[model samples]
Target: FDVTFVNKDNLPEYVWANSWGVSTRLMGALIMSHSDDNGLVLPPHLAPIQVVIVPIYKNAEQLKQISSHIEPILLQLKEMGISVKYDDADNRRPGFKFADYELKGVPVRLVVGARDIEKGTVEIMRRDTLEKSEAPLEGIAGHVKALLEEIQTHIYRKALAHRQEMTRTVDTYDEFKKEIEKGGFILAHWDGTTETELKIKEDTKATLRCIPLDGDTTPGVCMVTGRPSKQRVIFARNY
Candidate 1:
């Protein structure tokens, strides 16, 4: 039976049947993909606050000077259409603010203190690698903009590499079972039948994740039944 729609002229029309919905599962996927032991490592493009400025100072006078120096850089970033936050509140300590913004997934963090002002430099940290470096105050805004773009690309490539490392190709049911226990994507052949799919699930608790629309389409034999198969499909244990 074909699933489709009816036209205004009372004629049956062909349309692609699709399923769509919004859920918090997307948030879960984001956290699982980029988060680390420290906290969330959000890509800059998706971050609400792509950059956060944390002022490190001992006294109000020191903060006043630091804020004076940081204000221009903050304005420049905002002018360039980059979302940024200047955290100079007196209640929270600078260390606490650093931890909070890091946990919240701000991609770039700039720390400016009395010494930095004297040296005409700011300490910058990127959440993706948690690497810190010093940069002169001159043209800091433009540097941060470029850093955000770099962070986004670096995290994406890192996640891609991780996925590739975790994925496995197996030609035997015994190898499939062992790989499934390790928990990642498994590419294996399955005879195109509902009974075979159900049998595999019953035995291993792994299901066909998807039949990729693109990729290798070479013929193979089902690992379980030794029957001819069209192509390999992604199989994995759902969480």
Candidate 2:
């Protein structure tokens, strides 16, 4: 239910519910949480274009040859249910395409020039790490599939690590106030009362984000009121 733990005439009732669909908030969260200096850093599974192939060539003939070579690779990737984009438009340069796709957060990018074709390889770059390497074109599709999974996992772990680093535990109201100013989640004991919660918010401008559903639930006393508290709640200025 949208409204939980409603109180009526000094009586309380619980409502357990969930939201099934997603909204624009999911998109906002994706961009805000994962983006960096270069641009968006989308997880592979979430990226609309998981892989973008950019052709590097000196002339029209070279572009035609490169496109012909990449046709089979593109078909292979598509057959494996991977989204791919082959951008060979002469209107834009290769560097511009690279930067555009990087900003768009394409998970993986493959660059194949005449020289790379002669060597039977392509230059691959990962958006999350911006690391580039050359890989043979023979099994390039499978290599890309594996690399996408790796990128997904790497970005997820990186974001989790950042969250863990930002979370802090505070034992005193004064410490909570100090920590909240620095930004990030603060774990602090809170008396189960509206008065104390409101007072803390009024004084420090931090709100109780949640009474964490799991983890270290050991009993403790409220930092602000010194009342017996069951567990620590999460507090933050804003997400």
Candidate 3:
């Protein structure tokens, strides 16, 4: 059913949008595009935290004491503009939390239990590469901030490289299909007609994602119809 609401005593313009119902599918695409057999490799900037602090304890008293100590540290980190999460949940094991956080792409994790407290340090784990280091409890906020920035930059560069490696230009339908199967954006000539667009979609399942913002205005023949074309349009099977 379509419901209408009056705004300022006038009808508003109706905008149409398409959906693939692929929110879960998009996550799958990200995993396929970015992950290895080990697990997900999330882009650092998109990661929930550059740092996560997990406190381990054996009993209620120990948990309370550890939490009390960590609160000041968490506050300091927050004051310094660092995003931090302290996992004190009793429902899950430390190993499970570690694995789950890594899968979710948290950049850094710090484990502070009774043992680490005795040593006046915390176990800091890097999620991107499973790297671990010991960081002193004092002055940890600044150190974490710097490390998170580094991870963010590193992930962006890696994603850019992956995109570059996957993209290609094609001149023929046969070549276009071959590259598209490998999964990436394709640049090719089009006849600029709805009929040609429909035919291409019928054959390749590809659609015009957009007439790109900066397409070159050059004379060419349409790959499908052999019709004169002013420029090429971008085509892709979008999410």
**TM-scores, each model vs. reference:** 0.88, 0.89, 0.72
Stretches of model 3 off by over 4 angstroms after superposition: 1-50, 59-65, 215-219
lDDT of 1 by residue, 1-239 (tens): 48668889988988865454235777788889999988998989999999999888898899899988888898899999999999889899888898998899899999998999999999999999999999999999999999998998999999999999998999999999999999999999999899988988899999998898895689999999999989999999988
Judge candidate 3 against the unseen true structure and give its global Cα lDDT, from 0 to 1.
0.77
Q: After superposition, how far is residue 44 of candidate 1 from its true place, in Å?
A: 0.6
Question: Runs in model 2 with CA error above 4 Å?
Answer: 1-21
Instruction: Write out the backbone clash pairs for model 1.
Output: none
The better-scoring model by lDDT among 1 and 3 is 1
What's the distance in Å from true for residue 164, model 2? Answer: 0.3
What TM-score quantifies how close candidate 2 is to the native fold?
0.89
Error (Å) of candidate 3 at residue 128 is: 3.1
Query: If ranked by lDDT, best first, what sequence of candidates would result?
Result: 2, 1, 3
Compose the digit string of candidate 3's lDDT tens values, residues 55-142.
Answer: 8999999899889889998998788777778889999999999888877777788898898788889888776667889989887777
For model 3, which pairs clash? none
Query: What is model 3's C-alpha RMSD?
Result: 4.6
